[model samples]
Target: MSTVISHRLSLLEDTNDQLKQQLESLFEIGERNEQRFVWLKELVLELLITENTNQLDRTLYSKLSELENIDDVLLFIFVTKPKVKLKHIRDTSLSEVPSRLVSLSKTICEVCRANEYRSIFNVSIDSSGSFALIPYQFKDIQGVLAIGSSEPARFAGRVDTLFLDFLGEVVARVVSRIS
Candidate 1:
């Protein structure tokens, strides 16, 4: 009886160990997926900044679809002081654009629930979050890129702004060429 009990204990221990190993493997996979997404985003931004084409909108839309796997994206260019509108581009319905822009504040806007666009755009991400890239020099309002994912946590409020800012700079150059 003693021997049998010992054997059972050993088997239980082995099962626990296996379960732990499996959990660790799953965590590693999640980390790798996140890394891949970030890397792809970086690569696409680099390409956008370097590309010398008047078709900035087309190129950007294509890259956004391929890289980040976002559900929706909207690009708007407006002047700050006089609030003049230069251009607007959307991946979806035109009627939805205004409600989306309404959430944006006078300054750089971040993700928030009040933003109706954020809710709709977030449907595609495995992690859910919305972000906007607004240039520091708001005089001309150079450009703005709004991205949202279905994944609730993908574009957390804490994400670094460097990438989006870089994107804004690139868009500014593209606008310069076209304007």
Candidate 2:
């Protein structure tokens, strides 16, 4: 009977040890994810601040140039006719902008205009990279902020749009002020 009790205690101890290791591993992963989230948020905030500066296009290009993952950041503002107004190409080697990204930005702008929503966030992946289009409305004018990432999995499973939504609002305010 004593032997049986001792064996049961040993099994419980081993189980507790495994659980402790697992909990520690989970905490480490959580901390890493938290740091990533904070970094992303900071990048977005920097973009907003850059937009507020007098030199909008140059400042924006410089701000985005610092980010390695971002391939390109395009700003399309709706006018009498749809057009790609401002494009900041990260890679200087590219002769021209990719047609697919241009098309995607136009489509996103059209959707936002048709819906007349305050903001819309859309994401897609292609052979080039993962793309995110954030369309925002400031009064009558509609604009799309398109971001392209070389990492295919960068935007995967990112269902939470809180950051993007906040970014859209800030962009709309800035656009309104400039216009």
lDDT agreement with native, every candidate: 0.54, 0.54
| Cα displacement (Å) at residue 175, model 1 | 1.1
Candidate 1: where is the Cα deviation over 4 Å? 1-54, 79-111, 118-129, 136-141
lDDT of 2 by residue, 35-101 (tens): 7678666655665665432455665556555656665565655555333334441211112333333
Q: State each candidate's clash count.
A: 10, 0
**How close is every model to the real structure, measured as TM-score?**
0.48, 0.55
Q: Report clash pairs, candidate 1.
A: 124-150, 125-149, 125-150, 125-151, 126-151, 127-151, 127-152, 128-151, 128-152, 128-153
Write the residue-wise lDDT of candidate 1 on 1-179 in tens digits: 99999999999999999999999999999997798679766655655565433255556666676645365555655433333232234322334345545454333434545344445343333332455545422333344566655444446666666666666666666555444
